[model samples]
Target chain A: MTSEKKIRVLAAKPGLDGHDRGVKVICRALRDAGMEVIYTGLRQTPQQIVKTAVEEDVDVIALSILSGAHNELLPKVAGLLKEQQAEQISLLAGGIIPDSDIPYLKKKGIKEVFGPGTSMNTVIDYIKNYCAR
Target chain B: MDCLCRKISEEKERWVKTTLNKAKCDRRTDENGEDIKVLYTPDDICAIDYLSAIGFPGEYPYTRGVHASMYRGQPWTIRQYSGFATPEETNQRYKYLLKQGQTGLSVAFDLPTQIGYDSDDPMSEGEVGKVGVSVDSLEDMEIIFRDIPLDRMSTSMTINAPAAVLLAMYIAIAKKQGIPSTKLRGTIQNDILKEYTVRGTYIFPPRPSIRLITDIFAFCKDHVPQWNTINVAGYHMREAGCTAVQEIAFSFSNAIAYIEAGIKAGLAVDSFAPRISWIFNTGSRIFEEVAKYRAARRVWAELLKNRFGAKDQRSWMLRYHTQTSGVSLAAQQPENNIVRVAYQALAAVLSGPQSLAACSYDEALALPTEKSVRMSLRTQQIIAHETGVTDTVDPLAGSYYVEYLTNEMAVKINKEIAKIDEMGGAVDAIEKGYIQKEIEERAYIIQKEIDEKKRIVVGVNEYLVDEKVDQALFRVDKKVARQQAAKLKKLKKNRDGQKVQLALEAIRRAAEGNDNMMPLLIEAVNAYATLGEICNTMKCVFGEYRASGWSGR
Candidate 1:
């Protein structure tokens, strides 16, 4: 079960969306997949999300937003990470995000945007591959 | 064990063997994955006493239903949960819904309002009017209900945390509409317990939150007798992935805490219990969903009667609203959700809900569009008019399978409630993350089942297709944020700042003292104080609640 290191991931719900089923599911899946996952509970600002990701020294930041606030919140988190010199941590998110917004979110520095019907295994595998190098 | 029971079991054995020996990989299970016998006979419900358990409708322990005539007298209210973007757009949507034969109105406030922030706050950037309608001040509330008369419409606002402020705004608007507070009819979804457990739109601590709920109860009982002060909701939690049994058990547990808070606040049970409403999510699992409603009503009736010693018949009737599950909607084909929502709405009707809200097909992808919302409302109409489901009272009552499932669900849910009772109460269980962990575990199991192709999600796991879905989705313009911000600024500039300050200070003093804050909140809204200002003033007194996870990182 041992590897070079376990993938430390920070999962958080930013802004005022209270629907955390997706985020909690991802947090548990990543934790069960042998990643050190820290779930920052709901109503988090972008600053708090990135602060925990950096402080916990996580490799990935999984931002879950069902409130459709990702476009506004995602870039804020990414910008904060860049300003705080924590830009190396990959930003990925999944929720009720539309396919039309995926490209824009990706261009905004999100590594991936998982929408509805996404598999947890796919998410875990993506993180594993992204961190393997 | 008994000879008669053994004979009935032998008969069922013969029936299963002769009629139903087919494929066997979990084949005998319901949609919820619960094992079901091919036949349920008298022996299945041997322990039940019909006189006490399944009494007549409108009777004590109302497992059959809260009303005697049920849908025969009048069909369940076809209330659509509609709201998105600016208040003006939402008002238009409401008018359209009412014109399309919607009987009741349900308002869905956006994230900023739900969590008690004005649309202009820096914390509200990019989020205003995204999830629900952005309601910033009394002016927004006025516009939301503008040509719509307050006296006739029984509105339901799904806004918690800052429920007092919103309720205040509603009361003030009714006043402006020349309607007395006593004549105003509606509901404020002030159930904050589920927010701490599942939905995360909570502000202030649980203690103060409960206090505000009690304050609403006390105020509404004498002032706005028609208003439902708090709706004990399991709708969000079930959408968050709790099992049917947990939905009933946990929401009732939260109900117990609220009832206790009301009594502690010196309000009588009969005074508020009649107006108390329960909201359940109608899932795709037909039998389980029906049984969940039956079981939920039974549990609530018994909880009110036995635990709280409520004497009035109205206190024992568990009136509830049902909403089709949003989590059950598929994002793939998207059209499949119409069928799913129809079936769920059918279950809600069969379960005898006081009201039902059908989720539009495109809800999973975005806010429901005009066509989709109309389609959903027509879906309810079809059930009411074309389908004969509303012709009788609890049509599925006599079915052996339904009765057996209902009893089993009641027992399982009772066990969970007992466990929560042992662990102090719902509030304590939530603070301990007990319910959250249970829901998360169930959510994980369902997600894993979908991923493994065990549980079939038609358009997702099965019926695979690569065809692009070009269905129109309702999208909120980014300018909605700017517009709401600008409106809030103009309102602040136009209003008497000194009066707003005095009203907010009154709210703060009431929050600091043990006074019920509803009167002060109503005064604040009358003074044109924004939701954020009122909530921030209370926050200055009670402080905001910050939840750190069990990981302790």
Candidate 2:
């Protein structure tokens, strides 16, 4: 375990979905788990999220979309990250993601998909495992 | 081999005898983070004064319910929150719901409309009709309830930042229908404090926003006496990751701020306090949720009577509407959400909610379709009709566990309220990001528990399903934005531009002065001033609120 280095995360709500329960929950959970989380308030575009991720130099970017606009929004964010030369940072998606969309998202460079009911531990564990590797 | 045998024998002995006496028992904690005993006795509630804590229903300090025979005399209104795409579509849905036994109408505006943007505004691109119905101008509002009688039916609008404009449109519609504004009975979710802390749909900053809230209170007190001016909401706050105690505390603090604002505006406590309502979320925590509602009533009663010096019994009574928590639904094994919603609805019924809205099972995945929405309505109907749970007033009132939980919740919430009061008030707490940070921390702990398997959420971390279920979900039309934009452009071209401009100028003048804004807003809507134009005019006076500290630490 890194003794003093803070676990940094970028928590963003993508797409036009304004419902923020899941995103807020994840943000709280990550913070409680001793991670320094940066939450881009609502209605953040993919470009904005990517820019913030790069500037903040976050170790993880957790994107949440509930309006079923993930298929359109996530790819843009992933592409922006690559274009900005920030592809080394891990990308995670959450909030009502469908099983069918998981493999496709993984292919687009998203590391994992967290659907509804994903516990805070699962997220922390995922981050720890990925970061450790 | 001898050592291994001895270790095995010792372990067996420890498991069989020693561990049985020292095994940890499961202790339930309420949403407020208070520990609940495994068994509660009458001793737990010995301190509660029967006369003060729970007087007769419909009397002073209405702890049982606001009404004597709550569901027995009249059933709680099955108010469903529904809206979509265009004005015409939402109108049809309203008519359909009314036909399907929904007593009252609750309107949900899209994000753009909620934040005071027109359908054609650049900021509103790709979001015209994604979440809820888009109402750009008075024309759209007129189309929304074309045939529905404003006087006969109560309409509750879930709006915040642009609530003043929307309320004006409704009053204008009432005038066009030959119904005086005083005859209208409905509610506007003009609770903007929650918007800043949790919902994030705010327009102006805190000071000007409270001014707008006071403006509505003053207007409704004189003209629309029957209308509920503000619904101090804990629903969105709970959905945004606050615990149950925080929900009650923050919501009551907000209500107190509104009461103080009205008093500051030179209104009597009794004049507007009766019309101020509340909205809360009924979550998956069954007993805890019921206790929350009960505690909420007691707290509101004490605050209004003792703190605000409200003498009117009606002013002291707490009337609330509850919506099942949409966050509790699961996308995996979606059918389980039906059970979850049923329990939540049952809790709301037992908690003596004046009205209730049960979220659809498929809400976690997408906007509910017709069938899913029907199922949600049926869930509430079953509790009201089939289950016989609503036969008595506060059925779970005397249960030892419930009473204990209620008292515990009351104490915890009072403490939280005191904390916020020390930080100046709700507005100050919001500006300093105190409440937001607390909610964030609690939400994270809950999530972490789930992740660690310390909390079991069925069909998610456990009872894994390999197959997917086929369900029909609501899908917005792809061309909705383009079509809405075209309609808005046509509306601007066809309407009387001179009248719209004058109406906007009048609004700006009223906003600049210390004048009540409702009448000016009504005039603007009457002159066909689009929502965006009126909002832009206000924005010029009261600058837009930019959320500070977006980067979480």
RMSD per model, one decimal: 2.0, 7.4
TM-score of predicted chain B versus true chain B for each candidate: 0.96, 0.94
Docking class of 1: medium
Tell me how far the alpha carbon of residue A18 in candidate 2 is from the true structure, in angstroms, after superposition: 4.4
CAPRI quality band, candidate 2:
acceptable
Q: List the residue pairs that clash in candidate 1.
A: A18-B200
- Lowest lDDT sum, 10 consecutive residues, model 1 chain B, at B23-32
Q: Show pairs that collide, candidate 2.
A: A28-B444, A29-B444, A119-B451, A120-B447, A121-B451, A122-B451
Superposed Cα deviation of residue B289, candidate 1 (Å) = 1.4
Query: Which segments of model 1 are wrong by more than 4 Å?
Result: A1-3, B1-10, B13-27, B30-34, B550-553
Model 2, B246-333: lDDT tens digits are 8999999888888898899999999999998889999877888888888888888888989999998889888999999887788888
TM-score (chain B) for model 1?
Answer: 0.96
RMSD of 2: 7.4
